[model samples]
Target: MKLYTEEWMKILEHIENNDRDYKLFSINYDSNYWFHAKVKGDEVEISNAKFHENSCSIPNPRKISIKEFSLAFPLYKQYTSGVPGIRYKMQKRKIYNSSYIIALIHEIIDDYYFRFSNILNK
Candidate 1:
């Protein structure tokens, strides 16, 4: 698998330092960022699958399979605060009991800092 770009890594660092509200997303065919975590109690969900950077089509989902979603618990614990405590009453995919979701806050934060840092340096 390709490594994350300097931009991507920078975004991750920002997310680690600051846990403020943020939204991060990429066009289809872009593999600069990814989140390999589980959803349902037993089901694993890998987001940011194959690069799909096309602006016309739907955003690509980077996906990966796992023997058990639970195996990624440590990653989740280190990354996220906790599963969204409140559940939506609308239609939602069934998630693993302990499946951890890595929110993309880090990516956005990193991107933000990278841009801001560049401006300051300039």
Candidate 2:
């Protein structure tokens, strides 16, 4: 159930392989820090931005490995929960159902833990 584990990487890879477009955005309190991810077909891109409220800034996207994607989950959770004024959006409504990306991640994690427990029981 831990984040950023090998099994988590596998789940991310499986998601990336699926033919769909996904986007996730998380912003911290005051909007000083944020992370965004976009997945299309088999490619995934991630971007992080930090700036003062009065400043103009742009998020530079970069290709990221599945492992890096998995590692970012904890940081995203921390910022989204611990920081106030958090704003999050997952998946574009036009391209996919609202919150579908978040649900997909939970489903993958649940499936992974279930299989892992089965293995341990054997």
Candidate 3:
């Protein structure tokens, strides 16, 4: 999967012209990561944080790089593959559950990338 390519420009242009909020969740073995973006008009703010059970520590907001975006897909796939029966869950729980987070991230990624066919295909 190639990133920072011409296809990426299409995503950037879409973000620039639209007002949307998107978040991507990923997990590597035992650690969880959250990548968030808030776009308004021509302004875009991106930030990320490491997820912990007790708290989520966010670093300073900065522009997201293609490398980060590229790594997210595999991490997301690994997370979903490791979680069993996640797709069958019905009732939403009001607590900290990995399944819930996975489901939410799946929804967000699907919706946000629906506009960019190349992204999801890659």
Each prediction's whole-model lDDT (CA): 0.33, 0.40, 0.42
- Which candidate model has the greater lDDT, 2 or 3? 3
Q: What is the C-alpha lDDT profile of model 2 across 5-54, one tens digit per residue?
A: 56445555665665433333223223222333456444455444222233
Q: Which candidate is the best by TM-score?
A: 3
lDDT of candidate 1 at residue 69, scale 0 to 100: 23
Ranking by lDDT, best first? 3, 2, 1
How do the residues 1-122 of candidate 3 rate in per-residue lDDT, one tens digit apiece? 54434433444566565554344444435434444445434333554432323323445665444444443433344455556533333122222233323433364444555446547678
Give me candidate 1's TM-score against the actual structure.
0.22
Q: Write the per-residue lDDT of candidate 1 for residues 20-86, one digit (tens) a residue.
A: 3322232223333333332323223344323333222215432322322223322332333333432
On the 0 to 100 scale, the lDDT of residue 96 in model 2 is: 24
Please name the candidate that would achieve the greatest lDDT relative to the true structure.
3
The local lDDT score (0 to 100) that residue 117 gets in candidate 2 is: 55
Error of 1 at 26 (Å): 9.5
Give, for candidate 1, the lowest lDDT window spanning 10 residues: 86-95
